[model samples]
Target: MILVVLGTHELPFDRLLKKIDKQILLGNINEEVLVQAGHTKYYSKNMQIFDFTTYEHMADLYRKANFIITHGGTGSITMGMKMGKKVIAVPRLIKYGEHNDDHQLEIVKQFQETGHILYWSEPMSLSEVLRLVKSFNPVKFESGNKKIISLIKQFIDGA
Candidate 1:
């Protein structure tokens, strides 16, 4: 199963949903699709979508998913990454009115650069990215909190 996550941002992210719907229509995606649609109001026969669900239910869905297609919010991306799931992140562009700003691009690019996730963007179709997923190996997720704590402890001891 593929899980699509659009986090609880106020803006509608119909753009991403439309692309996924198209891919499903094209038969590029042959698996069951479940979506946490958030504010995006879209109807698709190819997917099982809900506006929201309990945290535990969401986590269960995440665990059952073979891979994840997500909006470029930090929480959504990191959750999949932290679980060792393959993540394909699409940034919501302000020009499309999907977000108030293009800040999502920054985090998406950072994660992509670090080899934690694949990203879908212009000049590359979702099908193209999906083809690459067969061989994509994501780097294991590691939290930065431990390093930050160590640095703070060192500073205090040195003082």
Candidate 2:
């Protein structure tokens, strides 16, 4: 089971949902899908759509996924990385009207280059990424956020 999260950023990314099997669209597109002009229906043959959910639901879904396909949101990616789950970070490009900037592209690039994650843009590469995900190993991370704790201490001490 793969979890595909399209963040709640007022973007229509339902197009990508059709490509995967047994996926859940993590956003508020329930009756408002593809027919924002006042129509009410969104039935994709491949995926199930969730209008909205709580953080616990999100965490539960994340824990159960064999792989993850999500936007380049820091929270989502960080969660996936911390769990060492196979992930495909697709940036919401401005051309696609998914984002206001291309920062996601650069962010995903840096994460990929650092061997922390994998990213896909093209449909063909997405297929390949799907195949490759099963074999990708997530790096081991510390149990506690020591670096952030240290940073906060530095700020408190005015260091």
Candidate 3:
């Protein structure tokens, strides 16, 4: 029961979808092209393809999912981390024509440095990464003046 999110970005799925068992793909799609690109009839059977109409609905799905595999979106990453869910964030690159730039990669690096999220560069190892999620122990940030200042600095510096 993996929540395989494609985010708002209508990125390619051919490689990523191949690694999951039971997936729920949430995002844009071209149903006709998906099949032609070898998305397989598996989506029609074992998986769900949804276009989230609102942010609340999307949040609901995020809360309900077992594991979160997403593109490197800070909002999604933060949501998953706050929920203490298994998150494997793969960055989207402009060279891949999947995003405006390589900002996601940098975000992924920063998230990894904080030890709050897991990242997978290649889709082929998603199973191994998912397995590792079960034993992962995330650092729970203790809130205080120090934490507040750190968070503020993060926003100011990153921005």
How far off is model 2, as Cα RMSD? 6.8
TM-score of each: 0.97, 0.76, 0.67
Ranking by TM-score: 1, 2, 3
Clash count of each predicted structure: 0, 0, 0
Per-residue alpha-carbon lDDT of candidate 3 for residues 1-159, written as tens digits (9 for 90 to 100): 456666666656434555443232432221222111122223554356554446686677667776677778887787778787777788877776767888998998888788788887754455566567778776664336898999999999999
**Overall local distance difference test of candidate 3:** 0.64
Cα lDDT tens digits, model 1, 15-49, are: 88888889999999999999999988999999999
Superposition TM-score, candidate 2 onto the true structure? 0.76
- Give the distance in Å from residue 143's predicted Cα in candidate 1 to where it truly belongs: 1.1
Better of 1 and 3 by TM-score: 1
lDDT of each: 0.92, 0.66, 0.64
| Cα RMSD, each candidate | 0.9, 6.8, 8.1
Q: For model 2, how does the per-residue alpha-carbon lDDT over 1-159 read when each residue is reduced to its tens digit?
A: 667777666666645555443222432222222111011134664455665678787888888877677888777788888887877888878887767998988988888887778898755455567667768876654455888898899999995
Candidate 3 regions exceeding 4 Å error are: 10-14, 21-44, 141-159
The prediction achieving the highest TM-score against the true structure is: 1
- Model 2, position 130: C-alpha lDDT score: 60
